[model samples]
Target chain A: MSRRPSPSSSTAVPAARYLIGIDGGGTGTRARLVDSAGRRLGQGEAGPSALGQGVDQAWRNIRQAIDAAFLAAGLTPAAEADCALGLGLAGAEVATRRERFLASAPAYCKLALATDAATTLAGAHAGRPGTIVAVGTGTIGLARHADGRETSANGWGFPVGDEGSGAWLGLLAMQIAQQAFDGRSAAGALARAVWRTAGGSRAELLAWCEHAGQQRYAELAPLVFETEADDTQAAALLAAAAQAIEATVVAIDPRAELPLALCGSLGRRLEPYLDAATRARCVKPAGDAIDGALQLVREQIRQPLAPGIP
Target chain B: MSRRPSPSSSTAVPAARYLIGIDGGGTGTRARLVDSAGRRLGQGEAGPSALGQGVDQAWRNIRQAIDAAFLAAGLTPAAEADCALGLGLAGAEVATRRERFLASAPAYCKLALATDAATTLAGAHAGRPGTIVAVGTGTIGLARHADGRETSANGWGFPVGDEGSGAWLGLLAMQIAQQAFDGRSAAGALARAVWRTAGGSRAELLAWCEHAGQQRYAELAPLVFETEADDTQAAALLAAAAQAIEATVVAIDPRAELPLALCGSLGRRLEPYLDAATRARCVKPAGDAIDGALQLVREQIRQPLAPGIP
Candidate 1:
């Protein structure tokens, strides 16, 4: 079933000399390199490699990070044929993007790929079934069950979804600021902070917002945190975000069996705002998405998916 | 004081032989042609002329409609020097855009310009001081008082504001549909309809939403109303919409004293859901935005703004 069996694989025993685990998202990509025995060798970071953004860009970033990782290990960059790689990337859930990404990959001893949320869960729980809510520029909750079935909550993307994400927080802040501008609400600390960041005048705000996307909106999220103490409306928004997180947790793991991990750009920041019950379910992550990617690659090397089956 | 004082202005009294009133919004533009005596002549409609969309496109559509209006009047298209014009155009509140739009004008006998909301208010009360809540692709409340001071609420634009608007309803429905897809909520009628319109598959949804704007979101609004009877969530969304409308009304007219008229693509449709007390202030509009523009032009012809002051 192999079109290009490795020269080393002809003996029927695998000869992978390297293992690399990669975590990629909207902001950046991280690669962790290890020996065949799973001992850490080197680590590298590169620019954003979210698959949906562009498969070519994703691969380029991944390759750059991989090269850096090998250099950090004090070796010439290893050949793709000698490496087994696992990638947990943002936007990999979109089947078409993932396929295009996979098709363009360099032939390796083995490869495994999944959405960043999936790998986050795997890494957080040390390969066991668990739940993870990642809230950054976007937000989503994912759970892996004992039955190997997976469920997810939120993570609906830009201006429409991502309920408790940084973008969501920023959008809510803007709503309040707009109402303030119209004199429908008080121009409180939150409104002032938001207006200052976006612009002060109606014309300025409209122009700034006209072409803004998720990242632009998320840039405003921090203002909410900074002004919450002095702005009741800001505090209310945080409370709502906390509620949205709790709801997502409940949705993903109704029985609360899976240990929950809230980790992303915004997730950990929101931890204190979460109610005690939801916080109680939260556990320290055993490892990160990179470690999960390592675990996934190890498994894939043991049992490779057939060529052309991805 | 106009740079191009009408040839007729030199006659000691304004001698414009014809008048035109234009109402322009996101979806289309309408031009109403009337005689110098203010008698109805003819009317014509054309493509969208919202200034925010594009100044060139707005002018092109306005000119097309104006030409059609003149033809419908069974007269040769009048020269710019012979026609006084009034325009109520969307996005006229953005000072810079309004400036750009006015700067590109054709130099008619006399020109009067205001936001569509202002002209709607002027028209709804037959040029008197009153309140109008116009809800279509977007929502806003505007009230002109006897003292000439004006108050407005909402209409904060898309993705963040314009609460209770068609776009808002569509956005809320899409939010629910996303949760349903993620197993966070039941797929009620609203969700099903939205998913169908947006594409049911996750990949399809993501691809569709990747580039959607305010108009794209507004396209899904009718589904909320269509499914309200079968979906409690849809009903609740409508109830929330009605509440938003009421809040705007109360925000603009806190004393509840002004005669309120609900007229727009969605304004009257949401009326039945308003509270009885709020509905008690409802009044039929005296005329449409075109009439208000006509009235505004009449005033401008009587006393022109100083040149370069717009």
Candidate 2:
């Protein structure tokens, strides 16, 4: 039986000089490489590594991103034993998959795992106490209190939750497009734009729906923003999404004391739509999730691996 | 090269004494068997036969339902040549799939195909000139005019269209349940019921969403009705559904001159929720889609096969 090398033994190796931070999500996996002093070396990206997709695929994507980062850094790809890895991954909140991922860790000198939300929060606050609402194709709100207590709200996956995310807006847009196609509702500019983009006929719309996944639906989100000014449907959907974002933030930080940051493609766009009080509390994130992942790695290197991590 | 047997030639067979009416939907395929005189012989049900599911699977499910009906009739399962078939199928509105289905017909004596909406209207009006709104797991409205002209509205499939459908209501309920699970929203009676039914935890809900399809979403629709009285979310959903039904009926028959019938599992339940004007036009259906499929077969037996139908 193979036993994990003890942390002290692994750290004794002379070549263990690099730290790799991974931000893995449904859309893509990104890796940032830094040295012992936290100097940024390079960054690279690969396909989605969301744990829900499959453990093998996730690992493959992470490896691909890491290798790219090494290549960009003008260094040969290092063996697992030469690096420490910190992974902030979507779907890592699910215990079974997360456990499988941790248990199957390669021969890295040291490693740590956390949900992408945690990494985003860490990055947003520069590893301090703060709140961040990450709203890209999906939505999640996380807060780290001054005392280090952490809380999260509304990060459910597409077509069900993920309110105020790109998927949420896209879903409402598609429904409006269907109503337009059936003539049950007036075809507003947003609906017309969606229909035009989706092939412009009921049959075409039907075909699109038959094959549509979260990504496909998310592709329609731009039309919602584009037509919001002239389309009541689009405006209503945005308002609802904005309201959800507000609700999410309030749930994560009820006292509104934490420095709040809105992150992701959709997050900044939603800032203008938030209520006065919430908007006043919002701040730009100090760093991205990659920065947070690097911070995570730095923390792990400074301390012993958490109990049972090996 | 093989050619379809001409309708005239196939009709000459003496064994063609039965008519089979098939209502093939996403949830299930149902078959109603009748003698030459239009007297009901038996009914049978099988798995989903929605054309969108794949023609081969749809055909297999339809055949299974027909076989079960034959067995229930206390008759030896007759060869395909002994039966004339009429199919009212969901997803038959897609021209490519419909054509493929028609082109691949088996050795039946004669056959007719129509959208489930058209067949439901036919059955509801009993071959008369009227309109019917079908509100089962999906929703559609069809109107048959006095001059034999027909029109339809809605009936788009789940997650995109199908407004006011069981799937629509259920999707909303699940979203509410997700919000409730995250403590982002209060767990109202409807949300609590859905959570209880879906295994009562965020993990269970996540698992459910991971594997959920249209059928699974439709399964939660009952909870909406079950808790509507005490749940604001349920009441709001039903009201939206009722408004959708009203909009569909108006779209199908704008003048409201035709007698209107509500049909399907959720149809009658929506009656009390309809606007007063739309409710005033509602009538009990004379028969269900099976009866219309039977009528369709009887008409085909009397008239020559329509052009372009092999």
**Top lDDT: which candidate number?**
1
lDDT of 2 by residue, B171-193 (tens): 88998888777668888999889
Report the C-alpha lDDT of model 1 over B1-310, residue by residue, as the tens digit: 4266553454434568989999999999999999988899999999999998899999999999999998898978988989888999999988888889889999687888999998899999997889999999999899999899899898878988899999999888888988888777888999999888999987787777886777888898899999999999999999999999998998899898899999797998999999999999999999999999999998877755445555
Candidate 2 error regions (>4 Å): A1-15, A306-310, B1-15, B306-310
Question: RMSD to native for every prediction?
Answer: 3.7, 4.2
Pairing residues by index, what is the TM-score of model 2?
0.93
Report the TM-score for the A-chain of model 1.
0.93
Interface C-alpha root-mean-square deviation of candidate 2:
1.4
DockQ of predicted candidate 2: 0.68
lDDT per residue as tens, model 2, A143-169:
999898988889878777889999888
Model 1 stretches with alpha carbons more than 4 Å out = A1-17, A71-83, A106-111, A306-310, B1-15, B74-76, B305-310
User: Residue A159 error for model 2, in Å?
Assistant: 0.3
lDDT score for residue B94 of model 2: 91
Per-residue alpha-carbon lDDT of model 1 for A194-217, expressed as tens digits? 888889987777777776778999
